[model samples]
Target: MPNNPPIIDVIIPANNEEQSIGHVVREIPGIVRSIVVVNNNSTDTTAEVARQAGAEVVDEPIKGYGRACLRGIAYLLNKETPPGILVFLDGDYSDYPGELEKVVAPIIHQNVDLVIGSRELGIKEPGAMTFPQVFGNWLSTRLMFVFYGVKYSDLGPFRAIKWEKLQILNMVDQNFGWTIEMQIKAAKHGLQYREIPVNYKKRIGTSKVSGTVKGTFMAGYKIILTIFKYL
Candidate 1:
């Protein structure tokens, strides 16, 4: 294996994403060594679509945001040699998979440990992000600055990390706080991290977390508590 061409792995946690999952999978850079799609108990044909798109599909029967991610990460962990870079993106197609190179390049070519895709810096289509979600991201990111001393914008699902270093995070969130949990742990471990702009657009379907009031509240509470828990 050439040292410059790191083995790249992409994990997509999908739930009923038949409409756009296929496109998302296809758009992922071919330079990626492997693509893992965690089908989280979708009633639709997400698994079939992803498989048809040449992505390895795994089942996460339990329905939790983090549940699917944990399952996917476990699959990666079991691999003989861990990938040099791990990229996590939503299967809903809201994030531009083509921009993945920009997100992972910092960690792959440089010495960064984590790279966050910041929607705040990128273009967000109209109605792509709900008002509450925008506010929530702003508020939560501000809290992180005040409490954790780390500055960040949107906790957009599109992100990347060093595979070996990520395992030490020991993330335990089985719900919406998975991103924040990883962020908190990264801060605690003092990992080198950076954020870059990534384009965003409206998803083909409604968001499971932000589409419903109850789900949004639960997500906000979980994210806040996750940060507080570490602090």
Candidate 2:
């Protein structure tokens, strides 16, 4: 491990998560150098709440998860001194923000390039993940193993990566394929990666991607399509 702690910055992509964005921001560990919440075309006061809770909020008028994440990355890249590590977290309270240290531990101590928080190996509250969400993760990961020869337990959004390694991925997906796109590119680029368990709970609001039939189908379709696109 380095004598000094690596500079860590967090990025949270939020839609209409006004009810949980504040909590997510406030609960993040103090080790983080900055917390950026991307307001992804939300009608609610997500930006206001996140700012009130000490997060720097950026607006992404386009309604895409990857778009919001890209906006956050752009904000960090403009900084005079960029962080050493970048953590991608959900604005929903479903994830335990306090466990951020655990998620980033591999990168800090083990010199791993990327770390994914695997909810599959973690303790989850009942009904935390819907059936479609579970099935989609299973199928998508299985397909990735077959096609890309990479084994991933869960494509959980709570993840961390070295800033330099993240820049090498050249992420371009503007929608549901954001997380998988990163993972796939990481595998292709030969980045050292690991997965650690992270507890999960019921989210404060309905998931925009998994709460409706249309949303679930679209997400599943996009994820599968993305896995094949890289092949």
Candidate 3:
């Protein structure tokens, strides 16, 4: 570890993730300074549960995943002490929050600009991912490799980025295109990045992006659209 520890913050975009948000918040490592859970117009007690679980809550009336993440970013922007490394994870409990150290290790040690936790390269529990989700990752990553000259296996949600480098990307995707937009922009900007294996399991409730037909279609379409939007 560096002599002066890095200040870290987490952002979780949640929509009706009442059953899983508490566990996700609790499982995050003690190194984190703050956990910001952006409630994306959830009808349940998602906001209350997150606040009770030790996360500072931000209400975003919009339902888009990227919108909720942006809300969290906006909250962090006003913080007195800015973070050194910023992490993004899901509120659905599919990702092992305890393994955030693994996600951010390269940034803390090797001076990497961005790190993505790849479920495809990790120990995924049975039934953790549906067929469509699997295929979409494969296609998207391949397209990225072809176009950007960078090899990436998965577009997993668990990711970390240096705070300074993140601002240069100017992320604007407001929905399913968020993750890919970051990856593509990082490559274009010549930021060093890596994908490490991360443990993944079946989530407590249905996944908003992969559980429904419409969600899957839109997410896939948006991811592909995002890959080419920069070109």
RMSD of model 1 against the true structure: 1.3
Q: For all the candidates, what are their Cα RMSDs to the real structure?
A: 1.3, 0.8, 0.6
What is candidate 1's lDDT per residue for 32-69, written digit by digit as tens? 98899999999999999999999999999999989999
List, residue by residue over 1-231, the lDDT tens digit for candidate 3.
Answer: 689879999999999999999999999999999999999999999999999999999999989988888889989999999999999999999999999998999999999999999999999999999999999999999999999988999999999999999999998888999999999999999999999999899999998889899999999999999888888
User: How would the candidate models be sorted by TM-score, starting from the highest?
Assistant: 3, 2, 1
lDDT of 3 at 208: 89
What TM-score does model 3 achieve against the real structure? 0.99
Error of 3 at 193 (Å): 0.3
Give candidate 1's whole-model lDDT: 0.91
Measured against the true structure, the TM-scores of the candidates, in listed sequence, are 0.97, 0.99, 0.99
Candidate 1 clashes between residue pairs 3 or more apart in a chain or in different chains: none
Each prediction's whole-model lDDT (CA)? 0.91, 0.95, 0.95
